[model samples]
Target: MHNISKNNEKPEYGWFVKDLIVAFSIIGFIGIIFVSLGIFLTDLLQLFFIFAGIFIIVLFLWPGLGMAVMNIILDWKDDDITDSFDEMKRLEIPIILDIGCGTGRTAMKIVKALENGGHLYGIDIYNKMAISGNDLERVRKNAQLEGVAEKTTFQYGTATEIPFEDESFDIVNVSSVLHEIHDREDQKKAIKEIYRVLKPSGTVYIGEWNSRSAQLIGYMGIFCFVFKPSKYWEYLLKESNLTLMNVEEKGGFVLFTAQK
Candidate 1:
């Protein structure tokens, strides 16, 4: 694992605490709506509000269920997300950059894979999501706990305008982040930015949620399904100068590889 920065800072778990607060606020708001209108209606709206509050509580209490369902609908794999890259075993030491690397799940894998050592940089635009939902700080703490503290750097930034220099990285990986962007132009800009920061012939790995029927409905599904089929891996090559390498389609994800 490339500890891209030298700060040796502990991973932060403060984001989860914020999630708790937001969850409570959602429940409270729903309660107020229900109480203010329950007596005027046939109880349909009241029941709906009550159910919404219950679901929010469930999300707070058992976030794993929500997160798992998210993975399933988004076709995001909890295990083996980067298993295809195992073949890179014999290559020279490669600098790996992970975009929107939530909680550092795949980042940890890259750390263990590169013994000769390289750089690991993670960027996320939403600090609350990165802190609470992803616990990226905790991931930094784990790296430190495991003595790889010298190899990782985490930053707060956006994908469309990565703060790194051009042609700096040997490999760049993005997992389960495209859909959340919700803008075709921005998504394209981000992809181009990834290519810009990569060295010539450098590899770019992208794993994203495939279109699943269940994902087309529900709130969580709506969240992940915002990015359509075209703006993803398939048309990226057509829109840019990168060379397509391979694509792996799993139940809910499409893992795409390309070279710049």
Candidate 2:
């Protein structure tokens, strides 16, 4: 007769080592409280035990959990490349424009990624935020450090009136900047300018507000009901000359990429 072994017991340690350390720390804390109240411990021993336990717990917990969080923060700080650029690279290294390029994250990222010769231009409406808040100088410094500063240029300009001839850029990307403007007419005009300046078959990308949390959704619902339908942006893009390529709704932001 063959006997079956029960493997049902949760292995006390594997994936959640940090959680285990935290749990142990909590238990140790409670135990320390009992010892202090009941046993009448001396001040030195009490302090030593409490500190040592806390230190040990943090030591065990920090590596995995802390490293994961650090990696996420670093990724957020770095430039992101969407898969749509694959075709852009395959065809030619086209001149790229970043509208509302606060601190030049996307602009820097694209410039660094390009091979051979390609020009990059960035424009921002807010002078202070574009230069100071976005760490534009840092981007410039990095570009110079990487020997690509000559290929990049930045200007203070509004998206509605881009200082360029028609059909100027091969690709334009605007990230996380629409809802803040709050002027529908100006927003439409800005988009039209983007379309006008983009060469035929060029790509335009827009990332904008896609959600309001449950707490804020009530306000959004009321505003939508009174003024416009839900997903007004989706319809706006439909009416534009560009063809929508993708809509990614994640991390409380929507990424919309289109081709002219």
Q: Which TM-score value belongs to model 2?
A: 0.60
TM-scores across all candidates?
A: 0.67, 0.60
Global lDDT of model 1: 0.65
- Residue pairs with backbone atoms closer than 3 Å in model 2 (clashes): 103-134
Flag regions of model 1 displaced more than 4 Å: 1-78, 86-88, 130-136, 213-224
**Error at 120, model 2, angstroms:** 0.9
- After superposition of all CA atoms, the RMSD between model 2 and the true structure is 15.7
Locate the minimum summed-lDDT window of 10 residues in model 2: 8-17
Q: Scored by CA lDDT, what does every candidate get?
A: 0.65, 0.61
